[model samples]
Each structure stands twice: as C-alpha cells, then as structure tokens.
Target chain A: MFEVRIHSRGGQGGVTAARLLALAAVRDGKYATAFPFYGAERRGAPVVSFVRIDDAPIRISSQIKKPDLVIVLDPSVMDVVDVLQGLKPGGRVLLNARERRDMKGYPTFTVDLTGIALREKLEVAGSPILNTPVLGALAKMGIVTMESAKSAITEMFSDPRNVSAAEAAYRELVA
Target chain B: MLTVATGNKAVAAAVKEAAPAVVAAYPITPQTEIVEQIAEYVSSGELKSQYIPVESEHSAMAACIGASVTGARTFTATSSHGLHYMHEMVNWAAGARLPIVMANVNRALGPGWNIWAEHTDAFQERDSGWLQVYVGSVQEAFDAVLMAFCIAEDERVLLPVMVNLDGFLLSHTMQPLEIEKAGDFIPPLHLPHAIDPQNPCGYGTLTGPDDYFRLRWDIERSMRDAVDVIRGTQERFARRFGRKYGMVDEYRCDDAEVVIVAAGTLGREAEVAVDLLRDEGTRAGSMRIRWFRPFPRLDLSGRDVVVIDRDYSFGFGGVLAKSIAATEGARPFSVIAGLGGQEVTYEDIAGFVRNRQPGRELWFGVNGDV
Candidate 1:
C-alpha cells in the first residue's frame, strides 16, 4: 500500500486534492481511499488529508501514521506543523515551496505551487489555491500518473484553468 | 458498476437506488454530504422523492415519522449533536411502528465540541427501540442501508433501523463500492399498520397499563423476529449481488484460543491485529458484531474474549463488554478505546492482546487512573 499525507490549511483544497488523488488512482484501476482529518471547520486552520492506494482493498481505517510520501501544499505550514513527522525511511517529500531545501533523509521535490497557481490565475477570493499544483508535483512520484491526475482535476473542477495549473506544475516540478 | 466513493456518497447512492418516497434533509458534519447528494439526486430527477428541508435534526426525524405514517418509505441522515437533537423523535419513530431508515454517522457527543468518530452518540440511543447495525466499510454502509429498508419494512419487523457508520472514519473515507440496484432485492415497502383515511382509526393513542404492556411485548417480539428476517434478507441480497453479510462477521475465529470482539471500524482493525498475533504463533481471532440491536449470539465458550468498545456507559463499563458479558456469561478483558476518534492502531490492539487480563476494564491509552 502507498500512503500519502497532504498538509495544508482549511479552504485551500487539501481535501479536494486528496480526493482527486484517490479518484485518479481508482480511474487507473487501483483501489484507493481518501479522507481528511477534520479539525476546526474554519478557514486558515491547519488541516491534514490522507490518501491510501493499493492493489488490494485497504482495510485499516486509522490515520496515516507512517506515510510513504508527504505532500505539503502550504510552505508556511512547515513552521507550525511537523509535516514530515511519520515519513518512512527513504520516503519522498513533495513540497510546494519556492526553493529546494536539503533534508538529511528522504528525496525532496520542491515546486513553486503558489507561484504556479498565481501564474495560472487559480485563485478563490484572492488566496491562491495551491492543492491542484501540489497534486501535479505529487504525480512526479509515480504513485499516480500525470494523465490520471489531470483527468481527475477536470472531473472534480469545472474551471479549465485548474487542469492547466496541474499540467504546468507537472512540468515545472524540480528536485 | 464499481465506483470510488466515500461512505456518505455510497449511502446516498444506495438511498437513491431505493428511491424512497420522502427524504428529510438536515446537514451535519461528516453526514452533510449524504443528504447533500440525496438532495442533488432529488433535484436532478434522479430520485423521485419529496425532500423536506427541516430547520433542525429534531424536525428531520419528526418529518420522517410524519411521512412514514402515510406508508411512505422514508430516509434521513444525522450525526453527533444532530442525533442527540432527534433523540425524542427517534424513540417515537420506533414506538409508532414506522419503518424509517436513518443513517447515523457516529460521532463524539461533547461539552468540548468534537466532531470526530465515536460511538457514544449511537450507544446513547440503545434503549430507543431502534434496530441498530454498525457497518465497517463504505461498501457495507451502502449494503446495510439497502438491507435496512427491507428489514424495517418487513411485516415481521416494522421497526426503524439505524445504520451506524463511524464519523469521518467510514463516513468521509473513500472506497470502491459495488452498488446493486435496490429494486432487484428490496420489494416495495408494505406497512401493515399504516394510517388509512378510509379506516378512520387512531394511531399511537394513549393506552392503559394492560394495552401498553402488550404493545411493548409486541415490539419485543418483532425485535426478536427481526433477527431471522435480517438474515434471510441478507441471504437473498447475497444471491442477487453475490456479497454476503451476517449479524456477526467472524474473522479467523475458528480454532483460536483468544478473540478480540469489536464493532464498526475497530473490528476491521482488530482483524489486522489478529493476523499479526497469529504470525507470532498466538491463537487470536477477531469478531465483528454487526447488528448491535439483536445482539447476535456469539460462542466465546472456551476462548479468552477481549472486548474493545469505543463508547462507555459512565457508571457501568464499555457498552459492548457489558452486552457480551450479559449474553456469554464470561467476564471479558474489556478495553475501552478510541473515544472521540482517538487513534487506535492494529499494533495498539496487538499490545492489548499481549497484556490482556480477565475481569478488569482497561481504558486503552488513558493517561492516568480511571
């Protein structure tokens, strides 16, 4: 089973990204489950969402304690929360950051997801929605293909620019 | 066709397939998506039903009862405080012999305000005369909701059925669900005691001690009879859909000396713990009690039974442990765990098995005394 944990603030589409990832995996003929750790239901609160993908049925319903990959949608969240708390050894980090930061362990991929969202004009009420672009970065990990991710984004969001944002992030992802 | 869906969406899809005559809508966290989807179905003409927008959860159940009395197949969904708000009507729906089906997303009832998965909300309604079935998976949530209507509408069991799923655990968690058309298995609902305008008879009228006692007995008799009706319904569903469910789902229980008994998602996790224990040569098994209402008879005769409950009864103990001990007459190693959606991993359950002792209630992961 491949478990991925996504960290972001509320109203930033963290849960949407998790669901899109699961839907993409399902579209690709694999079993997947996505759910959010619902804390305070207000905007700007730190939120976490999880996705589990596997060949067989995923049975365990507990939160992802040891995630195979961690996707951080908001770079500022790193100061407040431990985004890499339960990352397994040799696991990868997909960060929506401006610059690549060297970590002792694990392969880290940094993408300017906010910049990409701004460039693509993917903003809701002036705040850049970075989850879609972060999902594109997540696709680079090979857990879900870029094509499947784009299709899922299109299926979930009616706006055409969201697909463009995902595609752009998929191309602009850097390690 | 198989599709990826959260438990809430699966339930809404199942309800749509059932195509109830009326659906009362009141939004609550983890449960809101269900009624939201149902409302969408109703609005889009996918499901031809009357969607009653109620102000509160209490009114939701009240509306269900009102619609159900006219012999309409009714459905509703609620969670946590919402379930508590509908507490009075919950009992009324059952006592009135209305075949109402409700999806209850089990959540923690709070003074501190929590919306996480917990069984306390559902467990509080144990005596309300509702046939309760706690489901573990998104698929089971859909299947149980479909089967609930059949069981409740049966002449032998004209009681409301509460399909309980863990809030945000099974409720919000997505999975691949294989949904069968409800018309294939469930026939049109037939309420024997429905109010007919032509008959001009009174319903739920005041009864003296003599008549009231018999009415209560009748409900009890029907509740007991519901056990067989539920099994038969599930058997027919299996034949049609090729998926079978039981009142109690046993996993690796045969030839095992130690067993962990649980309900909902905890039981699913315990199965993983059982496999891990067996790998280390410990004879362990997991028993998932599906139907909490009928409380299926379990054989823990020679096995060291461990009861893991997500809800407690304050003064007594874990609700499941008490129920099991009442029926099986064996003092189980009771572990109260996962209240307010506290994370309980399979490894935590394995630790419970390793240090289990009989005749004591151990609150798993509790910091200090009691």
Candidate 2:
C-alpha cells in the first residue's frame, strides 16, 4: 500500500488534489481512498488531506501517521506545521517551491507550482490554485502516470487549462 | 461496476435509488454534502421527489414526520448539534411510529465547539425508540440506508431508523462503492397506521394511562421484532446484491482469545490491529457492532474482551462495553478513544490489548491519568 499526506492552506485545493490523486489511482485500476482533516471552514488556515492507494481493498480507516510520500502544496505551511512529522525513511517529499532547500534526511523534488498556475492562469479570486500543478510534479514519482493524472483533473474540473498545467509541471519537475 | 465516491455521496446515491416520495434537507458539516447531492439529484430530474429546504434540523425531521404520516417514503440527514437540535422531533417521529429514514453523521457535541467524529450525538438518543445502525464503510453506509427503509417500513417494525456514520472519517472518506439499484429487493413502503384523510383518522393525540402504557409496550414489542426483520431484510438484500452484512461483523474471531469490540470506523481500525497482533503471535480478533438499537447478543463466552468507545456516558462505563457486560455476562476492559476525532492508530489499538486491565476503564491517549 502507498499512502500520501498533503499539506496546504484552505481554499488552495489541497483537498481537491487529494481527491484527484485518488481518482487517478482508481482510474489506473488501483484501490484508492482520500479524505481531508479540517475543523474550521475558513480559508488561509492550514489544511491536511490524505490519500491511500493499493492493489487490494484498503481496510484501515485511521489517519496516515506514517506516509510513504508527503506533498506540500504551499511552502509557507512548513513554518506552521510539521509536514514531515511521520515521513517514512526512503520516502520522497514533493514541494511547490521556486528553489529546492535541504530537507535534512529525505530526498526532495521541487516544482514552481505557483508559477505554473500563473502561467496557466489557474486562479480563483486572485489566489493561484497550485493543487493541480503540485499533483503533476507528484505524478513524476511514478505512483500514477501523467496521462491518468490529467484524466482525473479533467474529470474533476473539466477544464483544458488544468490538464495543460498538469502536463507543464509533469515535464518541468526537478529533483 | 465499482466507482469511487465519498460515504456521504454513496448515501445520497442509495437514497436516490430508493426514490423516496419526500426529502427534508438541512445542511450540517460532513452531512451537508449528502443532502446537497440529493438536492442536486432532485434539481437535475434524476430523482423525482418533493425537496423541502427547511430552516433547521428540527423542522427537517418534523417535515419528514409530516410527510411520512401521509404514507410517503421520507428521508433526511443531520449531524452533531443538528441532531441534538432535532431531539423533540426525533422522539416524535419514533413515537408516532413513522417509517422515516435519517442519515446521522456522528460528531462530537461541545461547549468548546468541535465538529469531529464522535458517537455521543447518537448515543444520547438511545432511549428515543429509534433503530440505530452504525456503519463502517462507504459501501455499508449505502447498503444500510437502503436496508433501513425496508426494516422501518415493515408491518412489525414501523419505527424510524437512524443510520450513523462517523463524521469525516467515513462521511468524507472516499472508497470504491458498488451501488445496487433499488429493485424488488426494497419494495414500496406501506404504513399500516398512516394518517388517512379518506378514513377520517385521528393521529398522535393525547394518550392517557389507559392507552399510553399499551402504546409504549407496542413500540417495545416492535423493537424486539425488528431484530428478526433486520436480519431477514439483510438476508434478502444479500441474495439480491450478493453482499451480505450482519448485525455485528466479526473479523478473525473464530479461534481468538482476545477480542476488541468497536463501532463505526474504529471497527475497521481494530481489524487492522487484530492482524498486526496476530503477526506478533497474539490471538486477537475484532467485532464491529453494527446495529446498536436492537443490540445483538454476542457470544464472548471464553474470550478476553476489550471495548473501544468513542463516546463516554459520564457516570457509567463505555456505552457499548456496558451493554455487552449487561447482556453477555462478562466484564470487559473498556477503552475510550477517538473522542472529538483524536487520532487513534492501529498501533495504539494493539497497545491497548497488550496493556489492558480487565474490568477497568482506560481512557486512551488522554493527557492525565484517571
């Protein structure tokens, strides 16, 4: 089984990214589940969402304490929350940042998701929606194919720009 | 075919398949999406029903009861404070013996204001004469809601059924759910004591000592008879859908010595814990009590039982553990966990089994000792 924990601010589409990832995995013929953990309904607050994928039915319902992968949609969340708290050894961290920073002991991948969102003009009320682009960079990890990710994004947003943004980030992802 | 959907969406899908005559909608967190989807189905002409957007939960249920009395198949959904707000109507819906089905997203009630998953919201209405079924999976949530209508509308058990699922845990969690079309498996609802204007009948008027006692006894008798109705309905549902569910789902319990008892999503976690314990060479199992209203008698004759409850009953022990102790004649080690949606992992569950004091109440993951 593969588990992922996503960190981002509310209204930034972290929950949507988790759902899209699960959808893509399921479309790829794998069992998947996704959910978010949030108390307040306000925007700009820290939000956490999770995704689990496996070949067989996933039975455990608890939150992902030890995630095989962690995706940070907003770098500012790093200061407020421990996004790497339960990251397993050999697990990878995908960040939506302009420049890569040292993540202590884990391998990190970087993508300018905000820049990609801006390039693709994916914004809602003046905030760049970075979920799709970050998911695109996550697709580089090979857990889900880029084509499946694009299909899932299209299934959710039904917009050509979302598919384009995901394709752009999938090509420009850097380690 | 299997499609991925949230638990709330699965419930809305099942309700749409049931094709109720009326749906009373009031929005609440985690539960809001269920009714919102139902409203969309009505607006899109996917489901033909009278959709009433009420002001509050009380009015939502009140409208369902009103519609149900006219022999209409009715449905509603609520959570946490919303369910508490509908306390009076909840009792009235059952006391009037209306065959109404409601989806209750179990959430923590608070002075501190929490909206996480907890069972206190539904446990408070235990004596309100409603048949409560707590579901663990998104698929089960859909199946249980479909079965609830059949059980409640039976001639022998004309009481309301509250289908409870953990808020956000099962409510918002996505899973591969197989939705069956409500065909001959669930027949049209026929209320034997409906308020018929053509027959000129009086309904729910004041009852004196001469008749009130007998009415209450009748409700109890129906509750007792509901156990068999639920089993038979589930059996018929399985025969049609090819998926069988029990009043209590047992996992790896055949040759085990230590068993963990849980409800809702915690039961799924306990099943994982049982596997982990077995890998470590400990004989452990998990039992998920699905129907809490007509509490099924479990055979825990020779097993060390550990009860994990998400809600506490203040003076008494864990509600499920106490019920088991009263019925099964065995004192269990009670553990109160997952209150207000505090994270309880399978590792913590295995630890509970290794460090349990029989016949004692242990509050797991609390700050201070009790």
Candidate 3:
C-alpha cells in the first residue's frame, strides 16, 4: 500500500489531484480511496488531502500523515509551512514550481503548472488547475505510470481539444 | 442498488422518497443544497411535498417541528451558526417528540466564523434528546434518512433524528446518487399519514415537573431501543441493497491495544490514516459511532480507547472522551483535538499513539480552550 498527501491552499486543485490519482489507481484495477481534509472550512487557507492505493481493499479511515509521496501545489506554502513535516525520508517531493535546483535536499521534481495551464489554454487557471500538471510530473518521476496518468486526464476532461492539449503539455513537460 | 451521491443529496433524496408532506429550509451554505434539491423535486412534482421557502434557518427548523406535531413528516437543513440559531428548537422538537428529520451539514461553529466541515455543530447538541447519526459517505446518508424515519416514528422511539454529514467534505462533492423510485419500497413505506384527528388525540402536550423526569427517563429508554431498531434497519437495507453500515462498526481494532473512537468525517479521515500506520507496524485503529444517542456501550466494552472529539463541550470537556471515560473501558485516554473547526491534522492523530497515558483523558492540542 502507498499513501500520497497533497499540500495546497483552498481552491488550488489538491482535491482534484488526489481524486485524479485515485481514479487512475482504480482504473489500474487496484483498490483506491481519495478524500480531502476540509480546513478552516474556507478558501485560500492551507488545506491537505489524502489518497491511498493498495493491492487490497483500503480499510483504514483516517488521513495520511507519513506519506510515501507529498505534492505541494504552491511553492509559497513551503515558506509559511513546513510541508515536509511527515514525508518518509526516502520519499519523493513534487512541486509546482518553475525551478528545481532551489528545492534541494530530498528527491524533488518540478513543473510549472501555471505555465502548462497557460500553454494548454485550460479553463480558468484554477479549474483544470495545477493538479493535472503535477500529475504529469508524477509520471515523469516514476511515482505513477505515465500511461495511467494520461489515461486518467483524458477521462477527466470534457472537451476533446483540452484533453489533447493536456496530454501534449504533459509530454512537453516530461521532455 | 445504491448509487454514489454526495451525502447532502442522499439525505435530501431520502426525505423526498419518504414523502415528507411539509419541507422547509432557508438557504444556508452547505445545507442549502439539500433543501434546494428537495425544492426542485417539489416544483417538478416529483415529490408530493409542500416546499415552504422560509426566511431564516431558525424558522426552517421551527416550521418542521410544528408541522411534525401536526403528524406530518417534517424536514429541514442547516449548518454552523444557522444550527446555533436553531439550537432552542433542537430541544423543543425532541421534548415534543415530533419525529422530524434534519440534515445538519456538519460545519465548525464560530466566533471567527469559518464555514468548513467539522463535527462542532452536532456535537454541541449532544444532549438535545435528538437522535444523531453521522455518515462516512453520501450513500450512508441515504440509508440513515430511511432508518431515521423508522426509528423516530417507533412507538418506543419518537425523537427527531439529525442525520449529519461533513458539509463541504461531502456536500459539494458530486457522486452518482441512487434514489428510490415511487414504488421501490413495494408497499410504499411513505411518511405523512393522517394526524388521526378522528380520535382527537393530543400532541406536544404540556408536561408538569411531576411527570417531566419520568418522561425524560422513558425517552432515554426509547433512545436505547433505537440502537436495536437502527440495527434492524441496517439489516433490511442490506437485503435491499447489499450494504451494511452498523452503528458501532470497527475496522482493524480487533487486536489493537488502542482504538480512537470518533464520528462523521474524521472517522473516515482516520480510516486513511490508520491504513498508512498499519503498513508501518503501528498498532492503532478507530471506531465510528454511527448512533450517538444510545452511545453504543457494547461497542466500547473491552478496548483501549481514545476519543477524537471534533467539538468541545464547554463547561465540560470532549464528549467522545467523556463517554469513553464514563463507559469504564480498559482505562483508555481521551485525545481532545479539532475544536471549533481547527484542523485535526492526520499527524495529530498519529501523535496520540506514542503519547497516550492512562490516568487522565488527554487532549491532542490545547489552544486556550478544550
């Protein structure tokens, strides 16, 4: 079993990322669960979400604190918060940032999600959101299968053109 | 067959199916959708109900209470401060035993005023004499609504049932919700039968001090009886839809030396948290209290316990911890955390494992208040 936690502020696509990941896991014929921790019960506040995927039915009912993979939606969150509080020592960090060298220490990967959203002409930047971009980088880092992530994104978007653009951006981001 | 839906919609659809004659609710944030969907049903004539568009959350509850005593299947929805406004009738409906069903989208009660998911509002009404059942998903909300009607109308248990779900956590989320068609129950176990004025019976009648205590005690017995009725309803629901959500369901707590008991969304959150720890060799688990009124003693009969209360019982302490301490468990500790919508971070729960001691029930985080 593997757990993933996403650190994002209100309306930043943390919930969508977790759901997309879980749905992909489910599509992979593995058991999966995705849910968000409703924080401050408001927008623009730091919020966390949990996702679990396992070979067996996932039965434990709490949040994922010690996670194998932690994704941060906003780099500003790192300064105001210690997003790495409970990451497993050898775990991977995926950040939605433009630069990767500055995010030293642990194994880190970067993707400019805003840049991808802009390039793909995605709906309101907050809608198709950064989650899709981070998920693409998740594929590049070998955290989850790219094929699975691409397939998941294809299933998520309603328009064929956007789906094609997201897949293309995903490829461009990885390259 | 059960369909996936947000918990908010499930409860609303359940109320609609049961044929509640009078439906009233003001548009509060999270809970507003339940009544909004129900209003759609009424306007489309999909549900033969009187959709009363009220002006305030307080009146929504009051209208339900009053209509219920008139022997109408009554319903309403509210969250946080709106729930606070309806606090007075929370007891009024229960004392009157009006058998109304309300869906409280669990929101953090406020001084700072935030509208997110927490068990604060429902927890504040712990002793309100109303039956409270918290659901993990929208589907459970559907099951609870039907069970609430059956339990509340029972001759033994005539109390209102507040079927609660985490507001934004489950409310705004979309899912494929299965609603019972008009004749799905076969015999139509629909609500809102005649008030039987032919016999001129009295309802919401006055009770003097001499009879109040006995009446209250009897109400206690009725609540306990509801635990069994709730169990029976779960069984029936299973036969009808192959899903069983028991009152005191335990997961991985069997060989556990410690079990944290919680309700509503946190229980589900704890579910994900426990899975991660179990894989890492942590001997921790959780118990979800589906039925809050009866308190489900047998559920805690012999387990090392910690109570994760999302709300604080001012003047007292964490109700979950108190209930565990009062139940005489294996000297379990109570971890009071997540008060007033404060995030009970999953890490905060894991922290409970290494730091719990026996003597006093422990609170996870103490910020000014419990």
Model 2 ranges off by over 4 Å: B198-204, B367-370
Give the Å shift of residue A39 in candidate 3.
Answer: 5.1
Q: What are the candidates' individual DockQ scores?
A: 0.69, 0.70, 0.20
Q: Give the per-residue lDDT of model 1 (tens digit) for A1-175.
A: 9999998889898988888899889878899999888666678888899999999877788889999988888877888998889899989988888888975567998889899999999899999988677667767767788888887788778898888888888888887
lDDT of 3 by residue, B1-370 (tens): 3333456777788887788889988888778878888999999988999889888877888888767766787778888888889889888888777788888888876666778777868878888899888887666778778777777776667788888887766675433345665245422223343355457765666778879998798778888888877787778777886777787767788777667778876776676666656877877778888887767764555556667777767767677777767775545666666555556655567666556665455655553322
lDDT computed for candidate 2: 0.91
lDDT, candidate 2, B1-370, per-residue tens: 5677899999999999999999997999979999999999999999999999999999999999989998999999999999999999999999999999999999999877888999999999999999999999999999999999999999999999999999999999988788787877778888876778678855569889979999999999999999999999999988888888998999999999999999999998899899999999999999999999988888799999999999989987789999999999988989999999988989999999998778888888664235
Q: What C-alpha lDDT, on a 0 to 100 scale, does residue B17 get in candidate 1?
A: 91
Which prediction has the highest TM-score against the true structure?
2
lDDT of model number 3: 0.72
- Candidate 1 lDDT over B1-370, as tens digits, reads 7767889999999999999999996999879999999999999999999999999999999999989988999999999899999999999998899999999999998877888888989989998889999999999999999999999999999999999999989988888888777766778887876777667865558889999899899899999999999999999988988888999999999999999999999999999899999999999999999999977999899999999999989889999999999999978989999998989999999998998888888888764224
lDDT of 2 at A80: 88
- Model 2 clash pairs are none
Clashes of 2: 0
Docking class of 2: medium
How high is the DockQ of candidate 2? 0.70
